[model samples]
Target chain A: MLDGLIVSIDAMGGDDAPEIVIEGIEYFLKHEGKGRRARFLLHGDQPRLDKLLKKNPLTRERSEVCHSPTEIAMDEKPSQALRKGKGTSMWNAILAVKEGRANTVLSAGNTGALMAMSMLQLRRMHGIQRPALAANWPRPEGISVVLDVGANVEATASQLAEFAVLGDAFYRALFKKEHPSIGLLNVGTEDQKGHAVIKAAHERLAESDIGLNYKGYVEGNDISFGNTDVVVTDGFTGNVALKTAEGTAKLIGKFFNEALQGNPWSKFTTMLNSVALIKLKKRIDPRGVNGGVFLGLNGIVIKSHGGTDKVGYSNALNVAIGLAGSNFLEEIEREVERLHDEDDNIGFIE
Target chain B: MLDGLIVSIDAMGGDDAPEIVIEGIEYFLKHEGKGRRARFLLHGDQPRLDKLLKKNPLTRERSEVCHSPTEIAMDEKPSQALRKGKGTSMWNAILAVKEGRANTVLSAGNTGALMAMSMLQLRRMHGIQRPALAANWPRPEGISVVLDVGANVEATASQLAEFAVLGDAFYRALFKKEHPSIGLLNVGTEDQKGHAVIKAAHERLAESDIGLNYKGYVEGNDISFGNTDVVVTDGFTGNVALKTAEGTAKLIGKFFNEALQGNPWSKFTTMLNSVALIKLKKRIDPRGVNGGVFLGLNGIVIKSHGGTDKVGYSNALNVAIGLAGSNFLEEIEREVERLHDEDDNIGFIE
Candidate 1:
């Protein structure tokens, strides 16, 4: 157990690829201090990786390199690659998790492909109709886990309620927060509002004996304010909201850069403001919270951004390790079993 | 034509109703400087207003006070209010726009009630299937307009395309940006992705002779960035994304306030950083944006936040004045007619 857990990294998945991901891992290993308990399985071309390691040499007793000859194209359809390209890095990483060669899997590849592969290969826990992609985002009030960010856009009310339960379990295990509040994302907070499906799910959630800190309904704005700890929504809305936030931040950065470039005085001000800007960027960038754990799956699968750098990929790897090290998967099952025992359909909608 | 541009204010709407709304109007009247024009009709309890105005003075003579004996509670059911609460502040405000008593209406009241009343009274535009609530939110890059924000949760491809047109027109009129770039909000930037309706709309938009800067596809994160001038999505997703952005800003503000609450040293640092924070806040705050315009209505109908202060309500009134002043309805009609004349069905899927 002290050996911790090993996470396999698909070093070729993201935009920056192996270089930045490898550099980031090196940074962590060198700076993370002693007593950091975790091992790593970095998968990529051995020759390409050796060159990187030779230049930035570090002790790698706890890390191993796994070579994969095939690389997945970013633009290729996830389904096609999953079926036809078994030798690709993505397929190998999934295989690693299934074989128990790696405790968890982390990748910044095509999200759709990752979700599809996990669902088809790893399968879902008993009673789970659909697994969810839960994004743990830091809000001003607290952190919120927004589930189904893009896993399944259209879902039954029962699926939404199940997502809520899974999200609750995930948040509780990860954050160790007592009674994390669960909110149903809707157009309004009114009891009479929302679509037909949400209405049914709301009723089911209200009646559940799963000991959830149910907070009724919340809107998109509620997520950032930490008004609710676990925000449950259909994948369509959650995905849109998450992406819009990211786009807005990027736009803001661009505008500020242009403004600062207008004059020397502005440049000085920008320099003075760099510390605060960096802090704010760190606070808002989704990359900082790089990995979104695929909840309700048989084993842990953390999905990182496809545009991740070494820092981002390593962050994803670390998140996977942390989840595995903490026995997060076991605890989630326990919570679900407890909820199921209480009602057997605590998250089911009639 | 000048008389066809009067704005009636529901002084009873919003958190700090009447007083702040009144004060905001007074500020505009005093500071409007030159060439600014519009008449104001204040609809609320006249007795209380008379008492309040005794302490605050007005600069303009284009003011009329209409008595609304009853007030709709902020949290009251909008459906009930629309059907039953005749002669209430909200109802009178709607009547002002519908009956041509005023060219535009501005109310910081129950959003649901306002939306219900507008749809029922003003009716949808000719050949339009749905009316969308569009708001121009200030982002760090520039102003981005997001539409169908909770007016209707689900919308068809044609409806969304119509919203794109409406948003484009509004952005052009208000910001003076010629031929603004319009984006269909989706989870992925790829053409084949997104729900069936959106994919259909995307195709339609691409082929149409709509004289729009048709930027292929945008994800949610694209909203805050100047990447797209107008972002269109179904009401359910749009509303959630807008609110989530607002909530996040608020939470961030709260965090900063709490972090810098005490100690002279920290206070000094905060004061030093206050300018940046204020600038950022002004750019992100929905209240700063003030009103969400109900497009495709017969007349301008501005929906203000129920929790807004008097200043916010006044800003809502001002937004209405600007919308009317700009002859936004006429422009939209012209644009719609142009699109209709093209006889092009804008969509990818049938």
Candidate 2:
């Protein structure tokens, strides 16, 4: 019954709504979406989307619009979003996946609203107490995934264990790695380092026979080291760390510009090295890593940065298409069941 | 009677000890410590200290070596250090402050051991639950201070409130800013964004008017914005954020280096911009900003990086001399008492 990989999109969500969304799809179909059977179910005001789609021929050829009368505010509270936000573009975007009309959902909307609506409609996968937002973190060489970036403020030991299983499957499904290493983010690498919750989660990960590449504990530096494929932590710590890294990257970029443009001679020399500088700029470009995949949900949901441009949104769409085309959801279901089975066996053995 | 600001130094603590310590003192005496009545009591093997001190004319003239037979290892456990670490150079360094022989203590030793011995010797000030380690965080313009970087794993609401007071006095003394704005670090700026602990701290700081500048909440990005002078969080989150920023800075530096060396033209251009690059290097140099100060203790104890060079150690020595001369302790005591009085009045009003 499924006709190719369908991506449900909230076209009216981000700062520059239907414009960026339509142009982003067009950009992706030309760049990253070539030769792929990626179809989009755009959810937004039909009048505005039609106008934008007329301007974007590639997106017009590959997508169908679903009329949505309302759009959630960017700064709306989650509870308020769920109360009066049904039938809205953001809500219907997730509803399409819940109704099995779409393979995955992608939204550049309010993260809290997207998370809230996803939980209300699709619900958590079997044995998943909490759904988490796993982000694509740029490492020293390649990319790694860090989970619970900002979905839940806190997580129990078992939930952290489930995150590992989910994140492991995520990395494996995306990169096709067989045994990607997992590291629990802690204050120190020692067994007796962080809070009681962290220690408990560490113990469960260490003792469980979940068959994961469970490396012991890791410090904050390990997140950027690239040796570890998956980094796990509660949402509070993960959110702060993510933003801190982002702020640091921006500050360094500013410092780099200042370094190159101090004087006329310096500026001229910097212009001469523009080719290499452009190459470096592409490598550390934030657009390359823009999507945050919502794991542990029954259906796939990817949240893009709310204030991103067309290029960043297109990168997120590239991720959504790649994940939609794969067996990512099925892989997670199998891993989650195996993790719970290990827990049950441990409970009985004890 | 105390003649001048006598600084007790753990000369045998760091990776390259006695050498860096002696050289660092000489460097500080010539630079930041010029015309300051700062005397040093170096604690280590006397023969080694004597040899190193003799090689450095200024340090030899200003410092007296205190004989200590043992030195704590770089990676020793706090409990083990507490039990068997007595009479060691680190322990004796704190002892000099406890006995009023020195105004402050400085060490480039194991952080856990330094914290443990300082607590055993100086103990916490009145109305203070746990001591906190405050580090200087470089902002976009000026510098800000973040507390509980690695002192305690968790902090209660009242402890977080107390950190505002301690960090406030710390900022004022170090920067001569009379009333610096304080911000509590959280996942988001919303009241309902983070864990209950964070919410409670927010409420406590919001309601209580201890006549301090307490801005409600800030995210990780705010730390580098330089708008807020003091950022407060638990040790777990603070430690992770600090290290995460450091790692990001280093990674960016690596990327910049790789960017400039891609081809012959880039190499020549980069060589031409060497003067500007050197200016950039000095502006963001980690050596200029070194040292972690232990607040809420009866005496001042500064922790320098264990693997830092003489330049880094000298910056830390500069902090030690500055704090030793101020009434930083008295300011915290007065603010803490006023905070408790406000709590009592609130209880009565209710």
Candidate 3:
């Protein structure tokens, strides 16, 4: 289904560098049969990537290496990286998407640097004031898309409305849904709740004809309860909420593990139920969903965690490939145009 | 230690009503020895409360029922509840604190109504612009005090500083820590991160000498990781983060249960490990830390979850008694005065 799709990879970005990045590519191609139809444009140190690719025959057969001498340091500031990051691997991968050499860009680099480079290179979409970073939040029902995780610190009322439209289109493209339920993440579900920006956004979203299934307001608990398909908010609060959830999950896991290993009875029981425990761990593992998609940009950019291993890096590749195959950028463009036209009509009516 | 401390209870506030309220009192006094040192002022339907208290001799001996014919509905709006809330159990409980009949008030009712009544009856402290809701978040190391959970939707920089002082005093009073490490919650640990209000607050906190051990910025994950003794933020973000953590915990618990019940082998192992699992659950139970302390007010008020049962309500009662015995309101007043004097000095320096 993804035949001829090319994904640009920053092989020098993550902790393990070319080794894990190349292994991740091999794992994805070997485990996911549809992945065989995809091609790769790997950017990194030429000699290092060449040696790693030589070890993985399958990946070597389906990939082409682009020699990039420079690499962005994991702790480099975004402004500093942008100023001196012309030929770096992370920059090259993003540039490939802008040059039409690849459909999407995937990097496990410093988030700040990646965001800054992508914004400067790919630029924002026609009607977007700022780009949003979105993540797939796992819930009991399925998955919900939460946006503005950390791309921008603050968002205005119009910008929040824009995020709603952006998230709606992104979900529709990925899930093939005609209409996905959308919600503005707030402190409370009531109309009178939240601050002035959120209240104004709620009023605008409710009145606007953006073809969105806007479900007024949703609280923090509602995000994981699967109350809506897309939860949109300003980046600061969304980032805090996302990290808090991740931390809480980790804390609970730590508690569970300690409890199981504390005594002889628990140890024996854990050994007996190792299969079930493994299944549960795999189901909730953060590595399985380790990608933050950059929205409201002209090109697709998926950010993998900087410290993630092969399994996590592969998941990021899968996310990028799936989004590229779906032509997500085209969907966003159409949605943005439709919303603009609707707004103009509403102005005339008023 | 409670001695002659009196805690006013809203007997008709929660979903289970006077029965659970009276039962919770009994459970606390029975399980926690320190609970018996305190007295109770029950506000509710006099005949119903009288009949329930009659069944528990210990509770009957220490409690005095105040006839309150009306009760605040769980879904009543704040404005509506305030206009016609006179003589209602929730209102009477707060009034008892204002009238100096009780050291503190505990309510398991509509959060909006309770907040409105508390603000109307108790009023904000002399130098405090807004009151904050603080909760004891249990972590692996210990409990961290997180404030501004849902009292004010938006907080100014000055108000955030006020919350820091309030939370500092609160932690000191309850935990007897003369100087608790405090952190301002934000998207990142970097000083330059977050919005204008947060940035301003961070600068003010760093410069001002209100006897606070300000630990700079902390991210969402820090709250459960026990990075600081107190984590402060605007109520909107704080509420979202709190609920998100709760929702994530519930989701993980559900996943664990489903995985255990999937097969006979797993079920057998789960049965064998039931003791360890129960112990873990008890240790992390949300009910054990059920109350949200209303800080920055002239008097102390605690809000319990409306849907909680006897165990949860008992935990809330314990929290109320703890604060009452510690003289939390007076501590807050003292802290506010010190912060004001320090602010005046800083203004002169600038």
Candidate 4:
């Protein structure tokens, strides 16, 4: 039997607060087969959590409620939150991981504050300058991982190369793929295209013996087409592409709905085919993949969408538990150390 | 009566060359109300052009065939095309504009070759360092213009600010909206969120008295939400976002199609609502907005997608004719000069 993994949860964060968080825990316990191999550390107002947890005896039996009087607001500035967030639920959850009481932390909170607190408490890994947020994007074949979504706006050539290694480790850990094909996102596929940083990063990644199956450059359309297993880019461009894809999907869905409701015949036809449409909708739903993992930190931290419901929040918790159960952190640390050793060997040879 | 505007067309370019190009011109002359106010300078092999023109009497009546024995291949490198591009049809069309024989040029040729030839022949406008390709993206309310889609991959703060002015003028010429609201595309809406270049550009745009209704920073989702009339960014980021949006739309469309063909019932539903669905498809068709206007050049040049059909080709021609009829080039030149004059005045005052 595997050792029981403990996931720290910031129950006071997100738009729905402790209610949705508790409900999500119940949903995960009910549906997830791996739920029996995990324990939970719920950080929030003890009184409210205790009341909510009473309805779900199984979750209450496997979870502990820790008191936290403060919570970060959704729109609070990162600096202000850092100054005043010592005892907040998000801070406490991260602290549990930092103190070795939990394997990982999961929060549906303000992304900037969560990233800020995680960086401060856990610190970056030995060879990493900045941590990146890796998002699991839905594609036709399966899902592809895209990194630096909004963690850092700009990335240097070295930082981009680091992102490739981080993304490679992430895909291996989550998908259990031995080697995932990685691509650097660019405007064009040619090596000569894009800016100097991208070209330099491409050269660095191509030349390095970092054990990554580095495919050359890929364009924006390749993200949805699943042309590569991992798509890496600077945070500003990645964030824009991610949000634009989301917005476009939403717009098309709206158009689809409007088209189905145009006439009586169309309405009847829609009713007849509602099941198929619902299946397609479920296949492409963003709620199933709601977490953005903060890579390159000493411990794992997952950020869930603030407005997600119990279903979405449960999915995020599942991702946290999955990462916690694996040796993801150790794998990344070992890879980074190995790459540094290789660099040292190259230096001596030169 | 309006003077007959001449639009130079490269009949040898695009996937469906002389046939589709000639058919598109016929289609435009058949239905377009402003067809009587414009004439076409058809540049290609004289024999092929004459044969295609014989089939469409109206197009032949309104168009004059120009002999161009050489043609640039779609896969030809920009440098190679630039070296030996004198007698090519794409070259002749642009040369007509440079020599003031045509008000504008339209080509569905290779983008790299078109950009290179336009830069070498027509040249850049005074005070403009690089030209930008501005694309009209469809939004729910109407349309928004996004610039530097794939022109120069990297941009300085001043270049980004200049794009805002170029985009503003393009929007005004096309949509007839004075003082179109412009926003800088960034990872977040907050002032301090993006990279140093974006921050500096934000300051430049916000503080300048350049007669622009600057709306500050906008996120990627804002492009489809129609939050701003113009969205400006570095070419690499803009190109990625644009292609990502296109890819997302395509993926959703595929899902929609698959759902509608799942069973006999869905097939029936699709049959019943075919008209409404077709209307929706037409509303969002990329072919209707096929042209990407190359801004900041001394003369106007429109690039059509190389694989587009007659419908798409006609739309590109319409865009060229529309801009040619308006004082689009003069508007850009005057606005750029005004901004430069203001900079000089500020320097003297300091």
Model 3 complex DockQ against the native? 0.83
Better of 1 and 2 by DockQ: 2
Model 3, position A54, has a per-residue lDDT of 85
Per-residue C-alpha lDDT of model 3 across residues A204-310, encoded as one tens digit per residue: 88988757899899989888876699999999999999999988988898889988888999999999999889888987888977889999988999999888888
Q: Write the per-residue lDDT of candidate 4 for residues A47-147, one digit (tens) a residue.
A: 99999999977679789999999999998999989997788999999999999999999999899999999999999999887899999988877889999
Error of 1 at A43 (Å): 1.4
Task: Identify the candidate with maximal lDDT.
Answer: 2
TM-score to native of every candidate shown = 0.90, 0.97, 0.97, 0.96
* Candidate 1 residue-wise lDDT, B1-350, digit = tens: 34435788888887778777777677666654224667777888999877766665662356777899998888889777876677888788888878878878888788888888878888877756678999777766567888988888788877887898899888887777888888888888876687778888887789887687888788877777556789888888888888877765565556545545444554555565555556654555566677899898787888887777645655676677777778678878887777666544432332
Q: In model 3, what are the clashing residue pairs, if there are any?
A: none
* Least well predicted 10-residue stretch by lDDT in candidate 4 chain B: B341-350
The 10-residue segment of model 3 chain A with minimum total lDDT is A341-350
Q: Across residues B151-180, which tens digit of lDDT does each residue of candidate 4 receive?
A: 899898878878988998899998899889
- Alpha-carbon lDDT of model 2: 0.89
DockQ score of each predicted structure, in the order shown: 0.45, 0.74, 0.83, 0.73
Between 1 and 4, whose TM-score is larger? 4
Report lDDT (CA) for all predictions.
0.75, 0.89, 0.88, 0.87
Better of 1 and 3 by DockQ: 3
Stretches > 4 Å off in candidate 3? A1-3, A33-35, A348-350, B1-3, B348-350
Question: Which window of 10 residues has the lowest lDDT sum in candidate 2 chain A?
Answer: A341-350
Kindly list the per-residue Cα lDDT of model 2 for residues A110-137, writing each as its tens digit.
9999999999999999878899999998
